[model samples]
Target: MSIDAFVIGIFFVTIHLLANELIPADRIKRLRWLSFSGGLAVSYVFVYVLPSLHREQHQLKDYASTFTMESELYFIGLLGLLLFYGIENSVSYAQAKGFAEYHAFFWLQVGFFAFYNMLIAYTVMASEIKGVQAVFYGAAIGLHFIAVAHDLWRKDPDRYRKVGRYVLASGIFVGWGIGTSLQLSSVMQSLIFAFISGAMILNVLKNELPKERDAHFPTFAFAIISYTSVTLALKYFFEW
Candidate 1:
């Protein structure tokens, strides 16, 4: 995708998120859903479909053919897993909170991350150097997992959900270490982390978030941002 298009997409997504999270109204929920759907549909049509149409008109192959089908399928699966967990968590939260208030905001976050990863993957595909692409992709996945882990850690430490989070983090780092040594496909490495993290997050948000005695937004945000920044910096400087 063009940088301009990507920036515009992010802007729309940011607006959707801010609206859903900060606004309070019955219509806000419906508006947020419509906005999210519209954003994703527009992005897919412009970035994926319109290009294919142009390719057909010019009798040229699809430019995105450079992206492996396996990778794309893996990303689709990742999206499905995330959506499943998101819906599941939303239901749980709705039951506890007596409304579907945060569901839109939750989905906004998911859409934002999905769009962010799509851009990152597009950038990786555009780069000709395989080594640099691998490092970049790996670093992105690593930072994502680190954020997931830190989010869990900021919740009540003694909560049973914390155990699941730790297990998920263990699986991620173990998979990362193995993928690093074996030079596994970036898509597969990302899936390994995605599944584990999604499962853990779903479990915690469902079973623990409602009853947690020590949940703090500041701590969660701090941990996620701090770890992500450190991971990104290390990936850039250490090439690991």
Candidate 2:
């Protein structure tokens, strides 16, 4: 494996493992940081993810054997969003019902995120993202993971600490292993990218853009502008 990919993989694993420490407990601090992270994630989605999806769509179209397959990748992206939304909705519903513990739902959510984490790590190595560009991509995603892990921790603190965190953390290496060992076709990798992009949009928006009382708009706006500018500079000027 390339050192850059390995390092980025470790970065994700570290973020997952130390998320409790990374995210503050104080409401205001947490909200502000989460807002900033949300902006970064959103910026990456617009600047990198969506464009990459479109590129993948074009690539897919070149190999289309059937009309349905031409645009099916975007549908897969929607499926990713829907899958995560269903998990989030179910968790909220269980909480509203005064359920003390979401035993089954907890595992289900963690399991899905584990797969999500795998996709994230896998793409880091398998995709065209490399060198400095991977650093930027990894940073945005690392912050996004912090927000997601923190949410899971809030949902089932005891169980998450005991088992959930480690399972999710392990997904990073598992994906890294797969990337290093198995060579997936370009079409398969493109589809994986599309799915993760959609899921990432939902995850970032849902957790970081909290209710009015919990959000910090100024911080969010600043982060969005700053990250977008930097990313564009890298892509256009430096050709990263």
lDDT of 1 by residue, 44-121 (tens): 233333343333323312334544342443344346457756655664576468665644544443443443334333
Model 1 lDDT on a 0 to 1 scale:
0.38
- Cα deviation of 72, candidate 1, in Å: 8.3
Residue 60 shift from truth in candidate 1, angstroms: 17
TM-score of each: 0.29, 0.93
Q: How many backbone clashes does candidate 1 have?
A: 0
lDDT of each: 0.38, 0.83
Model 2, position 10: C-alpha lDDT score: 85
Candidate 2, position 106, lDDT = 77
lDDT of 2 by residue, 1-240 (tens): 788888888899988887887665544376787678777888888888888888888877667664346567789899999999999888788777877666787788999999999998888877646778888888888888888888888888888889999999999889988887788988789889889888987887777666677669998899999999999998898776
Instruction: Please count the clashing residue pairs in each candidate, in the order shown.
Output: 0, 0
